[model samples]
Target: MGLPKRDQQYHTYADYLGWPESVRYELLDGVAFMMAGSDLAHQDIVGEVFAQLRNALQGKPCRPFVAPFDVRLPKPRQSDEQTDTVVQPDVMVVCDPAKIDRRGIRGAPDLIVEVLSPSTAGHDQVLKRRAYERAGVQEFWLVHPTDRVVTIYTLGQDGYGKPEIQELVGTTPVGVLENVEITWDELVARLPKIEY
Candidate 1:
């Protein structure tokens, strides 16, 4: 069953915590958007990215996480209730240990990776993109599973500059982490071809 339409209502992290655990949501500017389950190919891609990051970042202070992880994005000086935005990117890395807690991340992560799904592509590219920019996330990557491409956005002095898009080939370097690289050749061998 679909969730009730609450587009006209505003929500927050406190409200989010009280909701039934069975349901999942991503809040954008206090508006609740229920999340959908990812498909096989999507999961395959996500798994590969996370696995690569895990091995590459070993012995490093930064840690990587997969989705279903709550990332609370509060505005400046906002408390739990006052904070209205949260999301679960497919893969993320938190270099600053202070930002992580038992619940999840309390602040912006140094890097985030979102594998684009057809239904939520626009939300990831536009709404969440702007939110990440505002939260001061240093880097964001949009991975298109079916399209076999990745678009990277690095936050600069004036917000995110023009994105750099790359075809899924060769090795893609992690901008925020030094000596860490994602091997596309191996990922391609494992990823199933997903149609757009």
Candidate 2:
């Protein structure tokens, strides 16, 4: 699917807050990108990933949140109107309690997961990845539902290091989070079978 037409005027978090909640969007460098609804497979993967993260984070300080949760990436000392970027990752694990508020996350999350959808794959892989890296997200995962593969990126001194690829065959340890393992085969088995 194609992206929404570019608006002439740049948008801010204040403007985003006032927009209708029925429609979903993300602001990147003051530009708005409309978000498309996820399909069954995408939703299933998101749910499973969230469940796994949630289970691992149980009794821990870090917490997992699904999409539609605002993650405002603001510059230091910037107000809501001055803040331009606001994104909603498929699943985010925020370790800082201070960042959690009535609105949403105020800064970068510890880990972000973006499950690929046909409409938003490009943005997720390129634009969002760069933005997340710039915002200092520690770990980023790009999950391809159709291919049943996951590409993990870890932030380093220079930026994100080489991506570590993992196929959805067996259990794989989540590198960023200690002792956390995702049962890939179980997740794939539980996904709803779709016929084209």
In model 1, the clashing pairs are none
lDDT of each: 0.87, 0.88
Model 1 regions more than 4 Å off: 1-7, 190-196
- Residue-level lDDT tens digits of model 2 in 5-32: 3486898899988989888889988989
lDDT of 1 by residue, 126-179 (tens): 989999999999999999877789999999999998999998899999999998
TM values, all candidates: 0.93, 0.95
Task: Give the residue spans of candidate 2 off by over 4 A.
Answer: 190-192
For candidate 2, what is the total of clashing residue pairs?
0
Superposed Cα RMSD, model 1: 2.3
TM-score of 2: 0.95
Candidate achieving the largest lDDT: 2
lDDT of 1: 0.87
- Cα-based lDDT at residue 98, candidate 2: 96
